[model samples]
Target: MMKKFSLLVAAFFIACSAYSQYDIVIVGGTPGGIMTAIAAAKQGKTSVLLERTSHIGGLPANGLGATDIATRGATTGLFSEFVNRVKQHYIQKYGAESKQVQDCSDGFHFEPSVGEMVLEQMLAEQKSKVTVLKMRQFDSESQNISMRNDRIEKIRILNRESNKIEEYTGKIFVDATYEGDLGAAANVPFRLGREGKDEFNEVGAGRVYKYWGGTEGEGSTFQTDNAVQSYNYRLCLTNNPAIRLEVKKPLKYNRDEYVSMIEDVWTGRHTGVQMLQVTEAMLEENRKHIAKGNVSKIPGDVWGIARITNMVKLPNDKTDANNQHMAFISTDLPEENWPWPTSSWAWRDTYAQRLKDYIQGLIWFAQNDKELPEHFRKAAKEWGFAKDEYTDNGNFPRQVYVREGRRFEGMYFFTANDATAVAPGKRPVIHTSSVTASHYALDSHAVRKREPGKVHLDGFLSYPSAVYTVPFGVMVPKVVDNLLIPVPVSGSHIGFSTLRMEPCWMALGQAAGVAASLAIDDQVKVKYINGEKLQKILLGQKATLIYYRDVNPADANFEMVQQLGLRGYLPDWEARLNDAIDQQTAMAWEKLSGKKLSYEAGKTTRSEVLKSIYTNTAPDNRNASSH
Candidate 1:
């Protein structure tokens, strides 16, 4: 049976390769992959974007409507363009003053269908250069990919629609898949699971237990393990009867999967499912409960289905439902996803279907199960899958939220420290070769299943992160000369939590497109491309590479100030163009240029001196890539 199956799989790529050679071939029609194609299109570079799913957009298209953004300033360029288009989509479809427009929250909040429509609109604009082939999964056996030396030449992907293997040759290949399947097939060295605490000295490294998303401290004895974070479906749900479908029990429903929730309800640990309506009294009560450190007892006033699941609001009375952050028993299925990174197509599909069934069963159990409390069941009964969303998939989302995947061992390895500050309350490490800036907490979901005496699942951590820059090196593989990975990027497990956010991934995708174009233009390895030139091109496209407090994308001196910031002159947030340089700024400047800067109380200001230096100095002399 095994031999016969192997022969059947081998028959796919035995035929001739389809399509002409492209300047860039990107796998995964994720938001990152989509932006990559669009960015390449802007450069008049023809590219092909291959998606495994029927739809193009990843999570955002599925059910991730509430955008995970720390600040609007961190997301720009193509991502900003995408958001503006989403807002416009609502404005045109409904009126500019419609309730849907107000619900969009400046294009940040939206429905899954709206998100997909906006993304498709963005892709449509690049129809000339970007050819999107949906339902195409790349074969990741390391045999289908043709590699000459360290560069990828072509990849053979199985077209699920026609059951044919189509070969795509490209000057530069990008692995934007959440799984990093193309990179793995091309033999890019990568890391799976958690790194040891001492390996990177990352604060959240290793396997251990912690509370309320506060990660373990550095230099701990916890050992590294192949325990990836949990995976789940971000279900788009609505209570509106106009477009609501019953949360029916899946065909293969199993009672054991959700039987544990009954105990949670009895102990008052599992809250009701309705979205919470908070008041000042509820807030104070919740605070005191947490301060007391007895999580088994949630405040009576705040208990509900909201405790176990997150329902971030959207337009049309819908929600982008997700696994609750602090909920011990949530939608996320941990430990079982260990095989997902390297699993075969058949195995993955089976597992995904099983997971889909499992969640569907859980919802059914919550709504109609005999063991669940009457009030809990009633709270859940009002909810159902949004009928208008994912109509082909029976209102269920298509993409399962694969938060972390195979992180490549690239030129730069991002650890938890990158998201942390140099000192307490200070900015994170400023990269001179920064391609983008993003802000998100180190939010890793549970890495293990329920364990005895643990408040939350092990490795379920989340804490604040400083707004930090992502260096170009994170996307450049050390050995893959022509390949770049923007999604399953070069990040450690803890560091990946922040980079995994869709908004940041879009920015990284933009950088990958620009870098791929540069590599082809200069006829150099992706690593050898000029960093300053890449930053300049991205700046021209309106990307915010370095984030500052006072100076934003709107500032007239934004580009110059950002360049100066890279040179270590403007260390603080504010540019303070006319204000005298502080001691910290003076010290940072001296450290960069080896010259003494005199404040003289008031005469010298930031803009006066910095702009003069910038105009006189040649671009190469800036030494922005010194880091």
Candidate 2:
């Protein structure tokens, strides 16, 4: 049966063979792959983008309404081009300047079909240079990888769907998938889950801590520590009331598992937590929790869905269909995501379907079930499914949330020191410094139960952090010699908290593609590539390579930001400069970015309000990931 299946797979690729050879072969139709293909094409390299799924743009097009771009400068290269296309698409669809905030830039948040259209447009722009293969699974056994000394000679992709296998030789290959499958097949050493302090001699390991949202990694409490942040699907909910999208039940669904998780959440067990620490206290506390494996949070909070809090608004409007947002309160299908990174396609699909069912079940329970009250029903009802969010699959997103995965042990290991703002002159000087700046503190999930006896879930944590530089070396591996990681699973188990943002991944993907192209053209290994040359290339492409240390906070741009929109956030430069960035403020960026301000001079905050509303000392917990 296995042999027959193999032959059938071979037959599939043979029948649907599209392109035979190319300069690059990128597996996984993830955003990272899409961005890499775009970058490679723009660099005049012939590339083949093969994805297991039919659509592209990954999560942003799937269900994540908000895309996380750390900084204005990080939005350059192919990533910038994609954003530009989104702007143009939005303008064409919604009239001129209809969605633009006072900041003069149009916001992201367009329909999912529009997101696909934008990617398709990008592919069209580089038509001759790139070929996209959908529903094609790569088979390493058939590829016959011939390596001389250290470089890869050729790789063949067997299209299981069409029964056609295509072989191509290339000087470089990028493992752009969320799961570093290609890298693993190529014998790369990667780390999954948390890398305790003992592994890297760092302080933020082996324990669970709470990091707040706001500033850059600041205001964190010792709520829980030493746990990886949970994962879930970003539901594209709308309160439009005009459209009626039914919440369907998932197959093989069991309410018991969720019921338990949510039960723990109601008791403030494991819901509210940051992917990264935001505050010094939260970091410390998270360390303790990691040691104990008893992370907890509030179940009833809306942020309980998926604990992501930092959300920066883009040039587009909050209402734009393609616009991306981040938050602490989200529908995180935690139990569903555990198997995806290592699962086979069949398993992954089954897991995703289960996750969809879980989310649908949660929504249905919230709306129809008697457990929720009048206020909860009204609030949830206000949020419905988007009419044009996910165009490929029931307008439901096709991408799964990949919070953390394989971290390649690269030439340069990005440690806690690299992510810390106080590292002084230890900043890594990379050939290409992407425009994004990550501020969220090192954070992880707090495994708890749901509230109201509905489902066990809890989420929220205000951690402390400062904007840190992302080294180019983090993306490239050390021993494997050629592969580059372009998505959430880039480098640093703990540091992935901040770098995992969609914009950051796309930024890295664009840079990795550019680097691969350079390596091919200049005949240099990824590690040996000239930093100055790479930096020049990146800067030329408008990626913020330098920290712009000389650009005063009082510059015209700063003043313009103040005068136009985001009045509340105008003081962020001063507030965050001396302190760490928190999660709440970061999440606020998703809905407000350049247009609306997230803070006021003096307003008793939400966390504080909640604390005052319900005060209790959390029992001490030790983290297992701690040193």
TM-score of each: 0.90, 0.69
What residue pairs are clashing in model 1?
Answer: 213-462, 271-304, 272-304, 272-305, 273-305
- 1-627 per-residue lDDT for model 2 (tens digits): 999999999998876553465677777777678778877877898887877677777777665544544445434455666766777765665567564332225434444555667777777777798888787775433244655666666666667777676565566777777766677667667766555556665444433333223232232222323234455665565445565465655565565543443322223333223333234454455445433534332222232222222222322322322211232223554444655555566777777776667667666654544443334344445444565556547756676666665667665566655555554443332212322334445544432322342111332222334555566777776666666677634456556666666666776777778878877788777776655455446655555433333233234332222121111332223322223335665455434333333433235353332222122322112210010
The per-prediction CA RMSD against the true structure, in angstroms, equals: 6.8, 15.5
Give the clash total for candidate 1.
5
Task: Give the poorly placed runs of model 1, Cα more than 4 Å off.
Answer: 1-18, 213-221, 270-297, 300-304, 581-601, 620-627
> After TM-score superposition, what is the CA distance of residue 428 in candidate 2 from its true location, in Å?
8.9
Lowest summed lDDT over 10 consecutive residues: which window, candidate 2?
618-627
Superposed model 2: Cα runs more than 4 Å off:
1-19, 97-105, 139-148, 201-204, 209-229, 251-253, 257-330, 423-462, 488-490, 549-627
> In candidate 2, residue 280 scores what lDDT?
42
Taking all chains together, the TM-score of candidate 1 against the true structure is 0.90
**TM-score (C-alpha) between model 2 and the true structure:** 0.69
Global Cα lDDT for candidate 1: 0.81
Quick one: best lDDT, which candidate?
Answer: 1
Note the Cα lDDT for every prediction shown: 0.81, 0.53
